[model samples]
Target: MLDLWFSEFHAPDAKLSILVKEQLYSEQTPFQKIDFFDSETFGKFFTLDGLIMITEKDEFIYHEMISNVPMAVNPDIKKVLIIGGGDGGTAREVCRFKTVEQVDMVEIDERVVRLCQKYFPQTACALDNDPRINLIFGDGLKFVQDAPEGAYDLILVDSTDPLGPGEGLFTTEFYRNCYRALNDKGILINQHESPYYKEYAYEMRRAHKKLASVFSIATVYQFYMPTYSSGHWLFGFASKGLDPVKDADFKRWSEFGLQNRYYNPGVHLGAFALPNYVQEELQKED
Candidate 1:
């Protein structure tokens, strides 16, 4: 939760003004505000740390980068699963790749999906029309656990922060379930916490370790967002055997020509190059 703080100060010129703002994370208080955009479900979008995190804007960035990078790497990806993308932006992006034969979107909240479709049309417009896509309103954790082994080629966990309803998703059990739900060469992608901010690094590290236990290769990638606490954020990529850096065949990425604002063949290749500190931290068994 974001905390709000207020105080009054006096200057040498004898002028006094009241200061008010929000505190992001645990330490960073008095966050400044820019433009507040409209949201059908959440009321308004609050800008902080140079990231644009409106219900609509997050749909574009999160869905675009999450779905496209893996799809670009695995060009022949046929079966896909999206967990917790109630807005449906990830589903919309998954449909763009013609190689994808089927996509199953599992969202815990039926109301969020319905509200976004009704009010945030731009974010959820493509959900209802796509014949290749199936929207299933259910708990992502249970759904993945009960799913048959080697079912999905690509699985994306597009969930909220681990505070309320999303707590179970950040656990080690969830990662284990995801590993079991994937095919032999199946790939799993999840939204990790911010690298620039240390608030959730401990939890993220645990999640990373759990994924590493099951997958041959596990790596973290970063992207810049304007409305989040920090400008940069991380995502986890895990595969049974696919080496994200070396296994990515560049020829396929050139063929797709998926126009993206943030992700490209070069960006996809570079994102896996974690800094020295991050690499060491992720490897540690905290």
Candidate 2:
């Protein structure tokens, strides 16, 4: 008998490991290394370039928090553009909204989408069924840059940490393009790095500052993702005229009657109340 583990570093000083049942698959795509494993506790999970992307157990938290918060603030959102999120969890959550007429998902690697659809149907199920969705296999940065001005009502950047292919998605120029692609009332939600560790915290602050410079209102929200680095992750929320806290139409969102495991009207408001330390960190001069 042998013990097998799939592990990832939360920080240089810390790491998280899961008991592995089997190595389901492994591949090196042109963009990055990809692996899928079956874990005793977390169920089936996958990683990109050795970083955890999604797991069967807690995928709802990341997907729900990213999609629901913006939709709750503006129930009439029709066109949405998702950059990254090849796993399709983000798309699944966004498709739940009947008001959304179009969803354009851009992923750098088409292999991720194909693999997830084959191995993790739960997340990839809606990738094809939704007629509103237009799946684009290309670079996200270029999609936004080429997009017509005011082409979308919402843009959800479900990107990975700033590294490798995801690095360009975090740049100030990328944020600027996102602003131009969005309508006046459009909202932008991005995967803000965690604030728990020094390395991740630096990226968090940098991303907040970049978004703040591009959008009229910019803020960050927290959620618990057990598999991600610290079990504490964040999403950046930016908009031209909408304040996620002050302008969120809770009553209107509730009318949609969408059932969710982690997100609700109450949680939507509470997620924006950042801790004092996090606020202080984001306010630091560059």
Candidate 3:
């Protein structure tokens, strides 16, 4: 008998291994390596540059949380800019809001989108079907920089880690440009890394600090993602005026009649009530 396993190292001492039924595809793109696999527990899953990006069984959690949280805060959001969501999961969720009129998705790697479209249609479904979506294969940092001031009502930075192609997305200049590109009442939600591990904690704090410095209202919210570096994950929320907790239009959002697997009005409120340690970590200097 032969056993095949795919593993990822989160840190020097932390590792995650998954039993693989088969390796479906593998490629080395101009930007990074992409691989897809099938497994008993996760179904179809994909990785980039040796890191797990998403798995079918739990992909809903990350996509729903990132898209719905800000949408719930301002149910009237019509224009959106999605940075680095090449997989289209974020766009799929955002397009659910009939209130939304337009969406711009920018990805550094075109191959990630094309490959996901071919092999992982579960997440890449909306890329071609949604009329409101404008797909751009380009640099997210430059997209924000050249964006007209007050252009978008919301921006979802569903990016990879602050490494390789995604490194520039974490810069102070990028956050500043994001601030400038958002309308007066616009919101920005970004992948805020993790707080459960020391390596990711620094990125969490650094991202939070930079976002806080850029926006009048800024905070981080939590979610549990089983396969990420840690089960505990976060998203940075920043806006010109809306307070995610205070301004959350739960009743209005409920009117959208969207049933989600991991997000609800109650969970939305609780996600912001950060753990004491995470709060402390966000406050500390980088």
Model 1, CA-based lDDT: 0.70
lDDT by residue for model 3 over 140-241, one digit each (tens)?
999999999999999999998999888889988999999999998899999999998899999998988888888889899999899998789999999999
lDDT of 2 at 280: 91
| Least well predicted 10-residue stretch by lDDT in candidate 2 | 1-10
In model 3, the clashing pairs are none
lDDT of 2 by residue, 1-286 (tens): 4499888998898999988899899999999999999987889999999999999999999999999999988999999999999999999999999989999999999999999999899999899799999999999999999999999999999988999999999999999999999999999999999888889999999999999999989999998899998888999999998999998998889888898899987788779988899899888876
Model 1 agreement with the true structure over 40-157: per-residue lDDT tens digits: 4334343223223344445466667788778766878899999987767788888878788999889876766665576556667778889998899888999999999989999999
lDDT of 3 at 269: 91
Stretches off by above 4 angstroms in model 2 are none
Per-structure clash totals for the candidates: 6, 0, 0
Candidate 1 C-alpha error for residue 247, in Å: 1.2
Q: Which residue pairs clash within candidate 1? A: 50-226, 51-225, 51-226, 51-227, 52-226, 52-227
**What's the best-to-worst order under lDDT?**
2, 3, 1
Alpha-carbon lDDT of model 2: 0.93
RMSD of each: 8.2, 0.8, 0.9
lDDT (C-alpha, whole model) for all candidates: 0.70, 0.93, 0.93
Ten-residue stretch with the least lDDT total in model 3: 1-10
Give the TM-score ranking, best first.
2, 3, 1
